[model samples]
Target: MKFTTALITALFSVGALAAPSITKRQDTVTYKIHDFTERKYNGVNISTLFFNIESPPNSGGNIKFECAPFVFPTGKTSSTFEAGHVYFCYKDSPYSFSFVPGDAQKGTWAKLNLWQTDSKTKTYVGDVEFREPPCRAAGPGKDTVCEAQEDYQIHMSVAGSPTEK
Candidate 1:
């Protein structure tokens, strides 16, 4: 009996350590976009809001987005948008984004697909991707190579609506 109990406890402890931590934020929370390395991005206007590279000094802080209920263009009502989705408001207008895997050509950079947020039916605006600088060897004659490590990751900040403040 003692052996069995000890084994079960050990297994549970290992599982807990292996599992990734998850955070549940309110729907009205405000968040900022960043690369996996936690490098902040500036909102460069391409067609919609684009965060390609890290924010430069004196360029202000990171651009923020909201996770709030959106009002349909029909003005019928406001409802919570889809899960795993974020809404970015630019120039008093809201836009949505989706993540897509890169092709063989663009090895590490992932595609960020944009959507026009007005009506319930989303309009396919376009897509933008963040390309990292080419990876080089860390030091003299080493097998290890320091490659670009940007991925589809987001960091949330304070609580607020999708309005850019």
Candidate 2:
């Protein structure tokens, strides 16, 4: 009876000592606005390639999508960039902002292998391509700041956004 009581006491002591050491892994990231896709038809891109995303420790993360674009005819060049804001606690599974099913980015979404956090690079390169929808009356025109560009092909790695943990 005495031995049994001693064992129980020791176990409780160990549990109390070890409980405080375990911690949940947290990943924090921040990305800023860079430039638009490197294509001629990118006139339709929402000025900012993507919004600033910051997945904070406990805020369930947050995303600020800047779905804005230039109002006038803007020539295509890597140099053209808009002054945008940076947001944190944010986060896409699809090529879609709609999340309907097939990404409306172009009606199709191919899961990129670079979906991993370790896949970070200065510029993520892939032979990305998408279908093209000719400019129709209901849509943008040939030089009208409204063009259907398949922008998934090349990704610029310009520190694309400075992110950290």
The most accurate candidate by lDDT is 1
What do the candidate models score in CA lDDT, each in turn? 0.37, 0.29
Best by TM-score: 1
Which runs in model 2 stand beyond 4 Å of their true positions? 1-48, 56-107, 110-165
Worst 10 residues of 1 by lDDT: 38-47
Candidate 2, residue 72: the lDDT equals 29
Cand. 2 TM to true fold: 0.20
User: Which runs of model 1 end up more than 4 angstroms from their true locations?
Assistant: 20-24, 28-129, 136-146, 149-165
Instruction: Tell me the TM-score of model 1.
Output: 0.26
Clashes of 2: 7
Q: Tens digit of lDDT per residue, candidate 2, span 86-139?
A: 211112121112101124565773222111123333222122233432332333
- If scored against the real structure, what TM-score would every candidate get? 0.26, 0.20
